[model samples]
Target chain A: MKPAHRKIEAPRVTVDIVIFTIEEAKLKTLLIKRKFDPFKNIWALPGGFVRSKEDIYAAALRELSEESGISGVYLEQLYTFGSPKRDPRGRVITIAYFALASRQKLRIRSASDAKDAGLFSVDDLPRLAFDHKEILEKALERLGNKIQYTNVLWSLLPEYFTLGDIQRVYEIIWGKKADKRNFRKKLLSLGLLKPIGKLRKGLRRRPARLYQFKTKKYVELKRFF
Target chain B: MKPAHRKIEAPRVTVDIVIFTIEEAKLKTLLIKRKFDPFKNIWALPGGFVRSKEDIYAAALRELSEESGISGVYLEQLYTFGSPKRDPRGRVITIAYFALASRQKLRIRSASDAKDAGLFSVDDLPRLAFDHKEILEKALERLGNKIQYTNVLWSLLPEYFTLGDIQRVYEIIWGKKADKRNFRKKLLSLGLLKPIGKLRKGLRRRPARLYQFKTKKYVELKRFF
Candidate 1:
């Protein structure tokens, strides 16, 4: 009937990333020492303010590159944190992005915008600033649940990987041992992996057969997720 | 290292909702008339900027209550949207939430905040604003997948209801007619509903038996979805 009222609230929003990678048979996430006042001197996820010209995902990738110096990783939108009191100065909303990368890619060139940048084990993570620990937990839960149905685990594996490697990735992410037979059977049924007729080194027991991810299937079967 | 350069940028964040309920044998959502510069006069999900003092969930609930006048409904945090160009103005990230309610609870009190709040069928929803159309699609997909294992649909039923009522709720929400015979059998097998020895009213053919949700069992049972 009349002019609608506008909130006129310029809430500060930022993008935080939980960039995960498996290294030395353990799960690690990219962390940065805060150089700002809100959580100064504390360890936190790699993040930054969203630019007016960029979108949320772009902000996440930009923050990831600025804080961790890595790009084009398998990133997924995880959750948003808008707790009113999460930030002491004002209302700061943060969108979290979860990423998976192989151990080799963990050697990122720090963004130079943070006091320090490094990877930390999920199990022994330091106290993170502003509900990030909870955000990380939600991300892990999402990953645990999603890893069963999607081919996301491949993002944490090398270009060519064995079925055993894939199983191990699941085990580490889920923190539970899956039935090897069932896991292998389910993966094989997906029809997205082609046997490369090769074997990888560094196995105590028998080296398992290697397979390559079918990129074409990913495009055609976008519904797999 | 360089005292973390202060980025002169505005972080973008927004909120999306999957406000659904069962009404007239169909599941529906509350859509609003958007009369703004971006998506002028387009029918879109009612949402707003996240307030500084509230958490994302609280912000979602706040937006839901402000726009739909439906509060205290069981709301769940769904996911976050962060596509680079999802918002034309800037890089706006949106946190999505899904709310479930019975058909009777929705009360449209603010006609100015929302131009005629009414239930629209999920399948035949109006054109939405921003990436809200896609957000709603994802929410519906999540709901369909989740209804398979969780008793979340109970939130859409009355305190006491018939097996037929519950099955119909599932059918409407899933958009597929479920096998009535098997659906009833599976629900009963879950052992989460207790027959109250009461009969439903206003049945033309037969007065089906009424049952109360066994909340204790519902909590004890581990639902995969």
Candidate 2:
């Protein structure tokens, strides 16, 4: 309510993304080496400063493309980090997003400045710059919680997958092994997937039956772990 | 990536909140009349510009206390709306929060500048200022989705409640009548609530059994609608 309140400085905004994918039975995240000062050559999440009059979503996708050389995937906003001393340059706040994709879909053509892109396992990550580590940790918690109540795991799966295929995804993301008998019973009881009447050969040489999610898009499941 | 990007005019930040409570068997929200220009004399969600070097959560609570004259309640961060044209005075982005309180617990003591505080039903609200209507709509959607899988509805109830008491709350929220037998069966099956083994002397002189949530805090249910 004071007149001096109008003179307060505004904080700069940036957009960062945490792209996660399941590859080789491991959960991996995309990282990029910074090409500018204040963290030059240091690894960080793919992001950049928001442009004048640019929509936040546009800023997020634009940064992802410019820094990671990927485009045209949905990026869901995760959280905004606005700690006063988070950035060495100035008072900077970042709107973070998370994207889930299948390893078979990405065709990373590192756009010149993004020549040093890295995919590190969540269990073992290198030091990240500018409070990006905190942002990534929050995204990981969201991922664990999201898989609990929703069928969003569909984003990281092929068109049709076997029981072992889906169970392996859970095991990888959960960072543990699941009891096969109990896992199969619980998965079937949820009734979210349907048998396609087809089989995939060569999982221990036993033709594993393929199943597909009944819903076309991501949805909340009535039952969860 | 451009040289001029460094001076892209940072957008100002603000915090807004949606406070919902069950009053007179209806879902009501707290709003305030602006004391200054721009939206002066117009009703809007109780909020204000975030002060420089201030935490977003602190700003949210400060605005709620200064404008709505209530404090100390936990506010959950819902979403950050950063559309470029969301505000008329330059570029302003708002981080919104939502809180659910029981009507019996609230004691509204309107402060000087917030004399025109209003509590209107979410179903019948006035012409909201700025993008508040959109923000309010999003909060309502979150409220509906939240009650589906979490024990958050306990915030709107007293220490002890009967099956009918909880059922009425659901009917009010869903805006429909639920079958008595089926509702009772499904609610019991969730196993979230436990009978206290004490009957209250009321309801047509028929002693109605009371119940309490097993968990002391809000929790995500394994089974949901």
Candidate 3:
């Protein structure tokens, strides 16, 4: 086959992250307002162009930290969006990633090209720039699907959490209440949750038992899911 | 965050396809020998750079047809590989896709920048160029995982096939012998298979009952898996 002699300009590659956390029993995502032209001052997912020497994952982490002051969270490459028209500034493609973090442990501070940063309930997100609305929808679908079969919910909770806390995280992300008895039975059968030998403290009613996630057990059980 | 001051060259985005099929009870993939430098004359997954106006998925389909003359298969974006050194030709990011087709229907012909094209058993593949091996490995794992819960196996078989045909395809891809009774029981329980009230033609033994995949049933049952 003959090689085509036409030269094509490469599209700019950027990393956009959808950071999910649970706040006040609601599913929330971190968003930042852009500070420059081309969607300037509009809330968008936290991300930027990847440097030539940096790996894509590193670029994602850097942008995540620069915008929201978040680091060392459970991050995974969600998808790649390249519709030629998705970005207004010429041709641009984005490698979208989704991360899970504990809301109580995070301190949000807008920095760099972000005028402001905050966690907004996913259901009540503000108008976003670019194709961010589509990206956010896809991330939510993935998060909801993943919580059913994977142990990703552990990332959104404290080290010691009650079964009720875990169930609430599932209910909010999935947008449906799961049967408490069935949910508990399935989780215990998986053997990925270990009892902490203590009950949740400072509660007016009976304290629920606390449990911790076992990463080793999760790895083994993930295949079955 | 301040806009990154360093002017960076945009990475060339391309699409790569790992096409798979079942041949003689062995799982196989279509490979093409490259005709250009930076891995010239070496077997690799069929792909090319996305055009300025084309979507990534369209680019994958275009390259698959250009190199192997195959089209209208079950295609999905498998993953994105963008390590800085993944490609020797400067900075290039590849959006890897995998397609499934029946061996009996496809007619392979090397075209575009490919010198030759052939199907090779995945168990005994030739030395691949660039990071094609890594791409192929990930695709195999995904295909294996998907077949267990999804109706992707239908893409590797003809319109009318027996239960034994389906079981063989599963065993080859999963790399294990599935108990025949248990396999049929599980598939029937899922309600994703419909008998066509016909028998295998001209077989050396008693004719086996023919069946087809029920896409609607599979879609409904997918959420349960």
- The C-alpha lDDT values of all candidates are 0.75, 0.80, 0.84
* Model 1: CA > 4 A from native: A1-7, A201-205, A216-225, B1-16, B34-41, B81-93, B216-225
The lDDT-based order of candidates, best leading, equals: 3, 2, 1
* Each candidate's clash count: 11, 0, 4
DockQ of each: 0.43, 0.31, 0.45
The docking category that best describes candidate 2 is acceptable
Q: Taking the tens digit of each residue's C-alpha lDDT, what string does model 1 give over A56-84?
A: 67778777766666666688788777777
TM values, all candidates: 0.87, 0.81, 0.91
Tell me the lDDT of model 1 at A167.
Answer: 84
Output per-candidate TM-scores for chain A, rounded to 2 decimals: 0.87, 0.87, 0.91
TM-score of chain B of 1: 0.87
Give the lDDT of residue A191 in candidate 3.
82
**Residue-wise lDDT of candidate 2 within B17-88, one digit each (tens)?**
998888988999888887766677887887777776887777887877675566545467888888888877
Interface RMSD of each: 7.5, 6.1, 6.8
Candidate 3 error regions (>4 Å): A1-6, A216-225, B1-6, B189-191, B214-220, B223-225
What is candidate 1's lDDT per residue for B75-127, written digit by digit as tens? Answer: 88788776767766655667888888787777755445455556788868777
- Tens digits of lDDT, candidate 3, B44-68: 9988899988899899889878866
Cα RMSD of predicted structure 3: 3.7
